[model samples]
Structure formats: C-alpha cells, structure tokens
Target: MSFNIALSGLNAAQKDLDVTSNNIANVNTVGFKESRAEFVDVYAASLLASGKTKVGDGVLTADVAQQFSQGSIQFTNNALDLAVTGNGFFATVPELGSLETSYTRAGQFKLNADNFVVNSQGGHLLGFPVNPDGSSASVSLSTAEPIRIPTASGAPTKTSEVDVRMNLPAGDSYIAGAPGNFDPDDPLTFNNSTSVTIFDSLGDSHVMTYFFVKDDPNTNPNEWMLFAAVDGKPINLVDDSTVPPSATGIIGGNVSGPLQPTGGVGGARLTFNASGDFISQIPTLADGGIITEDFTNHLPNGADILQRVQIDFNLDPTGPNPNEPTQFASNFEVTALNQDGLAVGRLTGIDIGTDGLVRATYSNGTSQPLSRIAMVNFANEQGLTQIGNTGWKESIVSGEALAGEAGSGTFGTINSSALEQSNVNLTTELIDLISAQRNFQANSRALEVDNQLNQTILQIR
Candidate 1:
C-alpha cells in the first residue's frame, strides 16, 4: 500500500511536469491556449460492509482543462494578418484534409501567388463574393479565387443637354464697320450668341443656337435681343410667327438698331435647321459663341459633333425640366450622365470583421462585403480530444456545438492582422517544477527508509 502510494505520487508528478513542458513548448505558438492537469484520488468500496468510508487507493488523472483567457495582441503590418480583439475564432478550410472548416484565433493570413487570401496551410478564408460594383451577395467558394477587378462598366448614357460657357473677345467689329459696332477696348461693342448640342432618348442630335446681336451693346449688357434657330431654318421658338425675318431678321427684344447693314460691316444673323445646314444672313460669328474661331461646322446636330456627347434626362419632364431616365419596376434608381452610367472601381485590399464579414476595397473609393464566416463553440471545451497541430476534435463528452456570429450571443469579435500567443506563465511553471521535484525526492527518501528498516530487522535476526 505504501509503495502504491509512492508510485501514484510519481505518476502525478510526471504528469504535472509533462503539462508544464507542453506550456513552455507552445509559448510562441499562435492561438495556443494553456492547460492545467487535474488529478483525482482513487478509493476502494465494499458493498457488503458499509461502515465509516472506503479506503483510498491512489491518484488518477481527472481531466485537463484548457484556459480560454485572451492573450496580448501584437500589431502586424500585413493587411491580411488578424487577431481577436474580443472572443471568436477564425474559420479556415484546410487544404490536405477533407476541407472541413475549422476555427482558430490565429489571424496570420497572406495572399498567395494567385492572389487568393489564405492561411499558413493554404486554408481559405470564407467571404461573400461581390460583383463589379461594391455590393453584397450570398456567395460561397470552396477554393480561394484570385480577386478580379474590372477596368470599366457599361451604363446607359446618351447626349442629353450641352452646357455652353465662354468669354467673347471685347475687341470686335460687326459687319466690318457698322455704326456703333466697332470697339477694341470696350466690352459694350459686340454681340454674343452660343450653340449647344442636345440628344434625345433615341440618340438623335439637335443643334440649338441663340443669336445675340447686341440690340444696345453700349447700354444693356444683359438685355440682348435673343434669336433662336435649328439647322438652317429660322425657328421662332419663343413666339412662332412672322418668317424669322430672313436677312432682315426678327425685330423683337430690346434693340437700339436694325438687322440690315452695309457690306464688310459683318452684321449677320444665322439660322441652323435640324437637318444640319447653316443658313446665314451672314456667316456665324467666328469668335463670339461656343465654336472655335475657325469653326465652319455651324450646324450642331450631327453624329460627328456628338462623338463624346453625354446626356441626362430628367424624369419629371415637367418642372424639373431636364429629361430623367425611365424608372424600373424594382427599387433601383437609374441615372445617366456620360459615356457609361456605371461607376468605376479597382481592388485595393481585404478585411475580416469580428462578425465574420469579409470585405474588399477598391481604388475607385468603393467597398463590398464578400462573405460571412461561420463559428462553432463547444459546450465542453475540456472534452475536446487533441488532434495535434494545435487542433482539437469533437468528442462525445464535449456536447453539441453552438455556432453563431462574433460579438453576438456568446461568440466574440475577431481582430485582423494579429495572432494569439500561448497563454503559458513561465513563473508558475517554474514554481510547479520545483514542487514536483521535491515531492519526488521525498517519496524516494521514504522508500529508502523502508528498505533500511527491513535491512536492520534482518541483521538483528
């Protein structure tokens, strides 16, 4: 019985030493949780003679409980590296195994040659996949696919309206040298008009030119006589009467003079028809409107004139004025402004939130959620059977698993670009080692004393 007692102490001390050694070995390991060995005293029971209590037999291993306390976080420069700020595990699918999903607190992730984000063992990080636009969707991938970025997107667009802005040269001569028409330094001497191209929903082009021959150039800068034309035909858009006055032009608006003038005086009113022809009372102003000084293309309604034209039509068509895109039945709002109405983006980096949301960013100032990671928590962490490689498997005693999002319920948030170091305490381990060594020595001394007593008895006989 005494020998059995000493042997039990030896076994218990050996187990204590082994557990300490494990802690020290994994001190630098990521996602490693320290553990403590538990021991139970064995006892013999007699069913028939029940009196005071059963006699003690020896010590036996009860269990090894893992400590789940969070470790200190260290910052890492790698964008894919991660650490758990709170409580949660990173889900990864191992490559060589059955590709079964496993959870861990290690967050050291990296991009492979193919650009797929993966862990040290090439396990892929699950996430929601996104289309060209930084939108979310429920998509799954077995193998990590390289991030794909697009150059441009195709959107609905057409020539809608044109904006005209320019400063006409002040030094100018109308009709060569018409009376009150020549001034080199004074801005009140010339007339200014502008033409712009507009496109309909069907992409048809139209040229709208406003003729502004200063009625009173010296007095009214804002109060100019405005004449409008389309193609080469005179268009009385404001009133629609009296054949736009041909060479005499329409006599309307604030005017301090007449339209007709002498030769070389360059007082001309031009009209452009939608059919792309320029009818001139005189040629269009060379440097007074939207066109270039040498521009001979007076008609603004042509395919060639709208090669780079973009258009946005207002939907209200009424007060809002500009054309609007036709709305779809769904909740999506469609808008048009240029070449393609689609927004642009480029791949920048990736991130994983505590809730297991995989996000991707782009150079075009866009972001998208690719996927959500699933987590599993066990009822009996101690019941988990070790499978080496810092991994554990489900056991019958561990109970069913509880799976949910981090920071929600019992699960915790995950920190990116960090790893969890082993929770081993060297000071405690060293102290425990000393105690075990003393106990081993005392047990050996007791055995030696028992042997010496036997030897003395034999010698006395």
Candidate 2:
C-alpha cells in the first residue's frame, strides 16, 4: 500500500511537470494558452466503514484545465494580422464552402492565391456579408461565409454631365481677331482657353477645350464669345456666316448646317455689367446651367454612346446668390471641375476598420465594403476542446456560439496589423517547474524508504 501511494504521487508530480514545461515552451507562441494540472487525493471508504481513522489511498489526476486569459498584442507590418482586445474568437472554415467552423485567437492571416483571406494553415476567415452602405447584413453563424476581396469595383460609367466654375479676367484686352476672324486653331484669335478630359461610354478619354474670345470691345465691351471644341472638332453655336471657317468644318448654328445634326446648341454670349459682375449667360441659360452637345459622330470607338453631354455650371441662374462666371481683374483661373464618369478601376489596397468591416480601395479613387469579420463567444469558454493550431472546437459541454460583429454588444473590437501573443507567463511556469521537481524528489525518497523497510523486515524474519 505504501509503494502504491508513493507511485501515485510520482505520477501526479510528473503530470504537473509536464503541464508546466508545456506552458514554458509555448511562452513565445502566438495565441497559445497555458494549462494547469489539478489533482485530488483518494481514500478507501464504504457506506458502513468507521469514519475515525480512514487512510488515504493515492493521488489521482483530476483534470488538466486551460487558462484563456487575455494575451499581449504585438503590432506587425502585415495588414491582415488581427488581434482581439477582449472576449471573442475569430471564426474560420477549412474551405470556401465548408460549413464546419473552428474558433481561434491566432490572427496571422494573409491572402491566398485566389485573394481569399486565410491563415497560415489555409483556414478561410469567415465574415458576414456587408450591404452597400457598409453595414452587416446578418449576425447568424450559419450565414457567415469566407471573406473574398474583389480585384475590381463597379463597371465604367460614361460621363453624362460636367460641372466647371471659373473666373474670367475682366481687364484683359479683346482678342486680336474680330468676330469674323475668330479661329480655334490660331492662338491669337482667343483671349484664354482651357481643356478638360471627358470619358466616353467605352472608357475612352477625349479632350474638350473651351476658348473665350472678347467680342469687338468698341461695339460690345460687355459681350464675349465662347467657342467649344472636342478633339479638335469645332462646336458651332450660331448660324452666322460672318465667322471664319474651321479646318474641321464650317461653323454653324444649332438649327442649320453641319452642326445641326450633332446637337450643337451654339456658342454662349457672356454679358457682364459695368461693375464687372456677371449679368447673364447667352442661349437663355438652360435649366441646371447645362450646355447640351452631341458627339455621336466623334466617338473614337464608333459605339453609339449617350451623345448628348450636359455641361453643368452647378450655379442656379435664378437664385439670389448665384455664383456665375465672374469677370475679375485677376488672372483666368478654374475653381472647380468635376464629372460623374468613371473608368475601369484596379484594386489598390484594403483597409480593416475597428468594427471589423473590410473595405477595398481602387486605383480610380473609389472604395467599397467587401465584408465584415464575424466574432463569436461561447457561454463556457473553458469547455472548448483544443483542436491544435491554436484553435478550439465546440463541444457538448460548451454552449452554442453567440455570433456578432466586432464592437457589437459584448463582442470585442478587432485590431488590424497586429497579433495576439501567448498568454503563458514564463516566470510563473518556471516557479511551478521547481515545485513539481521537488514534489517528484520527495515521492521518490518515500518509495526508496518503503523498499528499504520491506527488505529489513524480511531479513529480520
């Protein structure tokens, strides 16, 4: 009986040493949790046995429990590396469509060959689908799916409207050429010119130029002629035969000649008051300050696009404080220029928000939400069964996982470009190692004493 008790003590001490050694070994491991060995003393007793002098039998290994305390965070250069600040685990799947889920605190993640976010072991990071407005669509565990970032964003949209605001120099002399001598190609014919790049339906770019010519200052000091052209093709505004002919074609009005079929509304006649303040724009200043023009025959791709392009000034012509083209003494300058058209975009980078929303940025300066990472918590965290790779599986002892987004309710916030270090304390584990070693030594001495006593008894008999 003494031998058996001493052997049991030896075994318990060995188990304790094993647990302490494991904790010390994984002190530098990411997301590693420390474990402890618990023991209970055994005693032989029956229902009618006397309770006064019951002797203990031996020690038993009760259980090996894991400690799930918070780990220190280490920041890294990798954007996909994630860390949780509080209670929660990152849910992941083995494959794209696999429903079998695993929970982990290890967040060393990277993009696979197919651009799917996965860990070093190829486990896919699961996330909730996000709406167009960057909000999570659902929080159900069943609805969580692997996160996949798109290589591109929305399709190209042709330019429909362009808004421009500028100030024209007021003190500048009239253009050298009169109305009849005005020519788009001759720099001396116009006082100032500005060009803008516009996109077609096929994502092709074209240069649209605007030329401002001061009218005959002797006869019309307050009048100015605006000439428009696209890709060197002059856009006619009026039907005056008095104007010089363009190399592309003869200039005509919106109602007659070659310009009529192109939906040209003719050039604008800007009129300013004596105080250099804008009084009105010619062609009756159409609704929304748009100048409609047709480019059906000028498209490079030959595809029929929305030929009618509306040039919007964004200033309300009827408003009391309308900001129109001003004729100031300052040099000619363009204040703002914006268009609604966009070209095909290439994926540039990705950003992860604190709320676990993943957004993808494009080369075209556009961004969109890709997915929202899913966070899960168990009712009994200690009941989780370790499945290696620093991950855990839900067991019957652990209640169902409660799914939620990061920073929602009791869920924790996600830290991007960081990793959660092991929770094991090397100092404490070293101390435990010493205690277990002493216990083992004491047990071995007891066994040696028991063997010597038995031998002495046999010799005496």
Candidate 3:
C-alpha cells in the first residue's frame, strides 16, 4: 500500500513537470495557450472501519485544463496578419469549398496563387459577402464563404457629354488682337480657343478643341461663331430638327456643311443681348445643351463612328447660377470644364477597415467594396477540441458557433497587420517547474524508505 501511494505521488509530480515544460516550450508560439495539471487525493474505506484514523489512498490526476487568457499583440508589416481584440476567432477551412471549419486566433494569412486569402497551412479564411454599399449581406454562419480579391476590375466608359463654362472676351478685344480669320494653324483667326481630352469607346483619348470667333459686327451684333475640331481635324455640326437635317450649323441663318479653316464654312452661332448677357442660339440649343459635333467622318482610330460628344453650355437666362457661360470683360478663362468618361482601370491598392470590411481602389479613380470578414464565437470556449495548427473544432461540450461581423454587438474588433502572441508566462512556468521537481524528489524518497522497511522486516524473520 505504501509503495502504491508513493508511486501515485511520483506519477502526479511527473505530470506537473510535463505540463510546465510544455508551457515553457511554447512561450513564443503565436496564439498558444498554457495548460495546468490538476490532481485530487484518493481514499477508500469500509463503512464499519474506524472513521477517526482513516488514511488517504494516494493522489490521482484529474484534468489538464488549458488557460485561454488573452495574449499580447505583436504588430507586423503584413495587413493580413489579423488578431482578435476582446472575444472571437477567425474561421477557416481546409480548402475553398470545404464546409468543415476550424476556429483559430492565428491570423497569419497571405494570398494563394488564385488570389484567395489563406493561412500558413493553406486554410482558406472565410468572410461574408458585402453589398454594393459596403454592408454585410448576411451575418449567419451558413452564409460565410472564402474571401478572394479580384486581380483587376472596372470597365471603360466613353465620353458622352462635356460641361463647358468659360468667360468669352467681350466685344472686339479678342478680334482686335488677331483680326485675319478663323485659322487653327495661325491662332490669329479665332479670338479664344480651349482644348479638352475626350475618350472613345475603346478608351482612346483625343483632343477636342473649341474655337470662339467674334462674328462680323456688320452682319449680326453681339454674335459669335463656335467652331470645333477633333484630333486637329475640322468636324461638321448639324441640326437634325431642320427640314432635311441641314448641314452642321447656320451662320446668320445660312446653312453650311464641313467648317473651313479660313472661317468661311460651317460654324455654330452664339447670340448675346446688348447687355452682354446670353439670350439665344442658332439651329436652337436643344433641351439639354446643343449636340451637333459628329465623328461620323473624322475619327482617326477605330472608334464607333456613330458616337457623338455634346458640349453643354447652358445658354439659358435662368439656368443654375454658375452653370451658364458668361461673356464678361475678364480675360479668356475656362472656369469649369469636365467630361463624363472613364478609362479601363487596374487594381491599385486594398484597405481593410476596423469592422473587417475590405475595399479595393483602382487606377481609374474608382473604389469598390469587396467583402466583410466573418467573426465567430463559441458559448463555451474551453469545451472546444484542439485540432492542431493552433485551431479548435466545435465539440458536443461546446455550444454551436455564432457568426457576426467584427465591431458589431459584443464581437471583438479585428486588428489587421498584427498577431496574437502566446499567453504563457515564463516567470510563472519556471516557478512551477522548480516546485514540481521538489515534489518528485520527495515522492522518490518516500518510495525508497518504504522499500527499506520491507527489507528489514524480511531479514529479522
């Protein structure tokens, strides 16, 4: 009996030492939790035996409980290294379509060959689908899916309209400086000229130049001719509302076709009142500004010939305060000039918010919301069964896993570019090691004393 009791004590002490050593060994492991060995004393006696002098049997190992306390965070340069702040775990799967999952605090993640976010062991990180407005589509665990970043996004859009706002030099000041005629090559024929970049269906850019020429004061008062050129080639304007859709424009009520560089052909007309205020337009300014610049015969590239660009000059008396073009006495200046178009874009960068929402930016000045990281928590964290790789699986002892977005409700916020260090404390484990060693020594001495007493008894007999 003494031998059995001493043997049990030695076993219990060895168990304690093993637990302490494991804790010390994994001190630097990320997301590692320390464990403790618990023991209970055993005793057995018949009901009839004297209760006052009862002795204990021995010590028995009860449980090896793991400590799940929060660990300190270590920041890194990688944005995918995530850490849970208060409560929650990062859900991961072995592959892309596998429903079987493992929960972990180790968030060292990177992109695979296919651009799917995966961990060091190739476990895919799960996330929730996001709406166009950057909100999670669903918070249920059933809807969580692997996160994948698009390598490229966004499509090109052609230029349809250009808002042009400028102050045309008053009266003859512009005409006086250069009085010959409207010649783009000479720069003296037109009073003022401005150029804007426009995009085609294929995202090809071309220069659209607008030349403003003061009309002959003798033919029409307070009138100016508007001529346009695309890619340095003169383009014709037309009013489809006319009887036969007469040529491009009407100068002083006369229709002309292709505008000539000598200032004698087709050119849109702008009429202003004696007070230097815009009042009317020739060939009529359509409901939404005039549209007549046609690329039917002048596009250099293989762009669609039917595509036409409209120059919007709100020639209205009551148009929004700052939208209409003014013929002020100031120097020729383009106050506002913008085109509605977009070129094909390339992926630029990605940003992850504290709420685990991912957004990607493009080179075309556009941003798109990708997905929201899924956060999961268990009712009984200690009841989860360890599955290695610093991950755990839901067991019967642990309740069902609950999924939610980070920073929502009681869920902990995710820290990107950081990792959670091991929770084991070296100081405490070293002390435990020393104590367990002393216990082992004491148990060994007891076993030796019991053996000596038995030997002495045998010799005396």
Candidate 4:
C-alpha cells in the first residue's frame, strides 16, 4: 500500500513536469494555448475503520485544462495574415473540397500555387460566399467553402452605352469667319469638339470624337450640324448607321447660311429656340434616344462595332430642362461624360474589411467581392481537442461550432495583416517546472524512507 501511494505521487509530479515543459517549449508557437495539470488527493475509506482522522493515500493526476486567454497580436506585411481581437476562431479544411472541418487561431496564411488561401500546413481557409455588394450570402457552417483567389486577368467588356452632358456656348459666333464646313483636321471648321475612348470586343481602345459644326447664324440662327468620326475616319450617321459608316465629307460650307450636307455624307441637324433651349433634331432620336456610332471598316483592328456604341446626350425629350445640354452664353464645358466599358485588367491587390469581407481590386479601376471570411465560435473553447498544427477539433465537451460573420453578434472582428501569438507565459511555466521537480524529489525520498523501515523490519525478523 505504501509503495502504491508513493508511486502515484511520483506519477502526479511527473505529469505536472511534463505539462510545464510543454508550455515552455511552445511559448513561441503561434495560437498555442498553455495547459495546466490538475491533481486530486487519493484515499480509500473503510466503514468503521477510523472515527477520529484519516490520511490521504497520495496525489492522483487529474485533467490537464488548456488556458484559452487572448494572445498578443503581431502585425505583418502580408495582407493574408489575420488575427481575432475579441472572440471566435477561423475555420479551415485539411484539403480542398474536403468537408472535414478544423478550427484554428493561427492566421499565417498565403496563396498557394493555385491561388487558393491556405495555412502553413496546406489547410485551405474556409469562407462564406459573398454577393457582388460584399455581403455574406449565408453564415451556416455547412455552406462554408474553401476560398480561392482569382489571379487570372479579368475579361474586357465592350462600350455599350455612353452619356454626354455639356453646354454649347451661345455667345460664340455661330458663323465666326466663314460658312461652317465640317473638317476634323482644321480646328477652325468646327466650333467645339470632344473625344471619348471606346472599347471593342477584343478589348482594344479607339478614340471616338464628336465634331459640332455651328451652322450659318444668319440663315439658321439656332441650327447646327452633328458629325462623328472614329479614329480619323468619317462615320456616316445616316446610311452607314448600321455598318461601314464610310463617307467622304459630312457637311460643307454654305456661304448663304442654312444647312447643306455634302453628297454621300450624313449629318444630323440640331434645332433650338431663341431662348437657347434645345427644341429638336433633324432625324429625331430613335426608340431609346440612342445615336448609333457606327465604325464598320473604319476600325483597323477588325472590330464590327456597327450600331454597338450608342450615345445619349442625357436630354429630356418630354420638355426643356436645366440639366440638358443648353446653348448657354458661357464657355464650352462637358459636365458629365461617362461610359460603360472595361479593359482587360490585371489583379492589383486584395483588401479584407473588419467585417471579414474579402475584395479584389484590379488595375482597371474595378473591384470584385470575393468572399466573407467565416468566423466560428464554440460554447466551450477549453473543451476543444488539439489536433496539432495549432488547430483544434470539436469534441463532445465543446458545443457545436457557431458560424457567423466577423464583427457580427458575439463574433470578433478580423484584423488583417496581423497574427495571434502563443498565450503561454514563460516565467510562470519555468516556476511551475521547478516546483514539479522538487515535488518529484520529495516523493522519491518518502519512498526511500518507507523502503528503509521495511528493510529494518526484515532484519529484526
């Protein structure tokens, strides 16, 4: 009985030493939680054996509980490194497409060869799918999936619509020096001109310029000729309205005033009232008030942009409005110039918000919402089972994992470019190590004394 009691004391002390040593060894491990060895006094009681006092047999090793306190955060240059400030853990999978989930506090992550976000152990990071507006689609653990970054170049989109708003100077001489003769080469031929860049199906860009030729003021006071060109080639707005808007001359000078479009060339007539308000156009706007800028064979790169690039002056056909382009007596100014077109862009960088939304920015001045970093919390964090690699698995003691977006409800906010260090305290671990060693030595002496007394008893017999 004495031997058994002494043996149990040694084992308990050894367990304490082992636990302390492990804590000290992993002091620098990221996301490592320090553990403490608990012990209980052992004793066997027999009914009616002792009425006054009973002695405890020895110490028995009990549970080793892990401490789940917050760790210090270390900022890094990598944007993928993440840290949680308050509560929650990052969930991951052992491999891509594998549902076997694991939770972790280590945020040392990077993009793999396939552009997938993974940890040092190659476990893929899981996240919730996001909408285009950067909102999480679902916060269920079952809906979580491995996050994959898109590194490939983004496809280009054609210039389908364009909005133009400007003021046609009413103070400028409609017929300055000579009758209006539309000519892109000579600035004197047109009063004002503006150019816009449009993209083709192949992602190539071409300059589409609009030339406004103020008509002879005396004969037609509020009239002008509208001509368009693409890449220095005249695009007939009428006949070539569909394809190959090939034309030699759009409009020529009429010394007597009025409007005269050169033969084989097409031009739209702009009419306005004396109040400088827009009244109508020669060939009124089509069904949707769209001016089809056709450049069929004019495009050298073989882009069939026939009636594809439509222009909207942003004018209200219902009645005269202040927002519409006006012949105001002021300097020519383009108030609004917008186009819905995109060029093939390369991935520039990534940004992760505090809410765990991950978005990718491109060189084309465009951003896309990728995913929301999934945050998970367990009811009993101390009850988790350690599976190495600074990761934990849900055990029976720990409640089911609760999935939610970061900064939502009880979930902690995600800190990007930061890492959570180990929670172990070296000073405390070292002190515990010394105490356990002394306990082991003292237990050995007790066993030695018990052995000596037994030896004396044998000698006397």
Candidate ordering by lDDT (highest first): 3, 4, 2, 1
What TM-score would candidate 1 get against the native? Answer: 0.58
- By TM-score, how accurate is candidate 2? 0.87
Better of 3 and 4 by lDDT: 3
Model 3, residue 83: C-alpha shift (Å): 2.4
Clashing pairs for predicted structure model 4, backbone only: none
In candidate 1, which residue ranges exceed 4 Å CA deviation?
Answer: 48-55, 96-99, 127-345, 453-460
Give candidate 2's total backbone clashes.
3
TM-score of every model? 0.58, 0.87, 0.81, 0.85
Candidates 1 and 4 compared: the better one by lDDT is 4
Tens-digit lDDT track for model 4 on 1-461?
78878889999999999999999999999888899999999877899779468777888877999998999999999999999988999999988778889999999999999999999999999999988888888999899989999977767787877777787888777646433345678777778889898788767887888777777788888776777677776655542233233322333332122223433345567767888787776555553234543555566677654535666665566779765677878898988778888888899999998999999988888889999999999999989999999999999999899999999899999999999999998888888899999999989998998899899999994
Estimate, for each residue in 101-202, the C-alpha lDDT of model 3 and write its tens digit: 999988889999999999989999999999999998998888889999899667677888889888777745436532235666767778888999988887
lDDT at residue 88 of model 4 (Cα atoms): 93
Question: After superposing candidate 3, which stretches have Cα over 4 Å from the reference?
Answer: 41-54, 171-186, 215-227, 234-295, 298-320, 323-325, 456-460
Per-prediction tally of clashes? 36, 3, 3, 0
lDDT tens readout by residue for model 2, 189-257: 778888888777766778888777778778888777777787877754432232222223333442543
Residue 237 in model 4: shift from native, Å?
4.3
Give the winner by lDDT. Answer: 3
RMSD of each: 12.9, 4.8, 4.5, 4.4
